[model samples]
Target: MLVLPAVVAALSIIFAVLTVGINFNLIHSIFIRKSLNKSKSLTLFYLRFVIDGFLGLQNAIMSTFILLKFLEVEYDEPVEFLFWISWTSMNCFNVRGILVIVISLDRTLAVFMPISYHNFRRRIRNFYLAIIPLSWPIVNNIVLWGVCQFRVNIPPGCVIFTCQMNQCYISYALSFEVVSHAIIALTSLILAVKLFIWNHCTQKGPKSRDLERANYLALIDTLIIIIFDIVPAGFTVKFPALSAQFGSLILVCKMSGYALESWLVRRALKRTNDIVSVSYANNSSMIKSTGQASSNHRHHRHINNHAWQ
Candidate 1:
């Protein structure tokens, strides 16, 4: 009975640690590595990774608590501490979904209208745009906290946050997750088709190839989101009893997904850097060769003129 939950809790903590490490590295790469920061899309991805790192830490702590409970180990914490965790968790969850939607839309625009997308990106400040999505989480949690304060009571001796404490907030959050994921799924499919057609019909160049690679990475991200997030949310809603039994496993899966995403982004950035380096080397060689040829031509011309004189 407790065996499965204990195993899952252990795995969740392990994965959470891995996820946090990967996210931290990715954030550092984006900040310190100029090559990785070239793309505007990565700005949003940077924010996502930051949120993911925080969630990973939270998941680790939560999983430890769950594991202790399964082992019948007694521990105590202030109710306020648990409440803040729950509140922050809710905000992070909602904010992550919104970021996914925004990223998907950004990819779609870049694919369909490359010139316009470039112009738009240049004109608008991504940092300011980011504030819009970031604000949603705070506003949402505040409202939910207010409602819980007045209308709902935190059950005594609650070990962790559960949806039963506030079904209204849970329902709204789940709905948002479902709808946003649906949009992401549809957009990813469309981008896949468009990329396929463009690849076959149009001439492939460095820019086009880079775009394709980035979009494919985004598609992989969508798959991760659908598998870890949407599936678990659906299971929780449709099979609450079963979901409760394996909640720790679901958290582990989510942490695994986040880790995978961070690793993929890092890999893609490295590949892009290699391509840029190679292209730069080739261009430098060509320029050097051209300069040598021009210099030789001028030398020969000067000799010929002197001989004619």
Candidate 2:
């Protein structure tokens, strides 16, 4: 049973690496880079990109730690310190959740208000947006550090679990998760409603099609985040003794979301390329038709000149 967690942790590490790779690729892509030049929404997405990257790295390291501890890998470090580090990382998962909420809100504004979204300055938004996501992690770490220091008892060899800890830690953490999940769920619902409304109100032209596609992608991503947060965290709260197992389950869902997002990005990029190709072909055909029309007009003029002569 212990080995099951270790195996899941290994798979988590692999997917976390994939998540990091895809996020970095997105950061470097032409669209993102161009957005850096053109859009305030880029700042929001850059924050999301950073948050996702941090989550991936955090998951990888913590999962590795979990695996090593499960295998009873020898380490000179004190058990208390190991426990502190692992649980602190686990608590910081709230920061990731809150960031998703920020992302959902930011995207909501962008999608619903094109005029305001485009007019917004990146500098102003970036400062505030950066503070929002960054602050939660700092506050979460502090609270987590305080709780673990004051509440937890560390067994000599096992860093992952100890016999006794105050209920405050679980209660506080669970409340945070539940509240964050509710907000995300609400945001997802709002986005879905707006998406449907937008589709119905708009004509089925290229512009509307593009907007629908973007909205649907954002809607799906938000839903995935909600699912990953709610299910495993709910189980963890319900079965605190099996937190390690539930944590592993959460990591699995996180990795699955990462994989799904990567696929979405690839699909979006492919669609963009296809649209551009079709546009280019249309332009080329139009130009060819214009040129042939001109050539025929010239040929007719030449025939009239010969007949007049």
The lDDT leader among the candidates is 1
lDDT for predicted candidate 2 compared with the true structure: 0.66
Model 2 compared with the native: what TM-score? Answer: 0.73
Give me the displacement of residue 23 in model 1, in angstroms.
1.6
For all predicted structures, in order, the TM-scores are: 0.86, 0.73
The TM-score leader among the candidates is 1
Report every candidate's CA lDDT. Answer: 0.77, 0.66
lDDT of 2 by residue, 4-117 (tens): 777877888888888777776667664555422223334555556655666677677766776786677877646566665566555446656776677677667766787777
Q: What is model 1's C-alpha RMSD?
A: 2.9
Q: Which residues of candidate 1, in runs, are more than 4 Å off? A: 33-37, 115-121, 147-157, 203-210, 296-309
After superposing candidate 2, which stretches have Cα over 4 Å from the reference? 31-43, 77-92, 109-127, 141-170, 200-210, 240-247, 288-292, 295-309
Which clashing pairs does model 2 show? none
Number of backbone collisions per candidate, in order? 0, 0
List per-candidate RMSD values in Å: 2.9, 4.6
TM-score of 1: 0.86
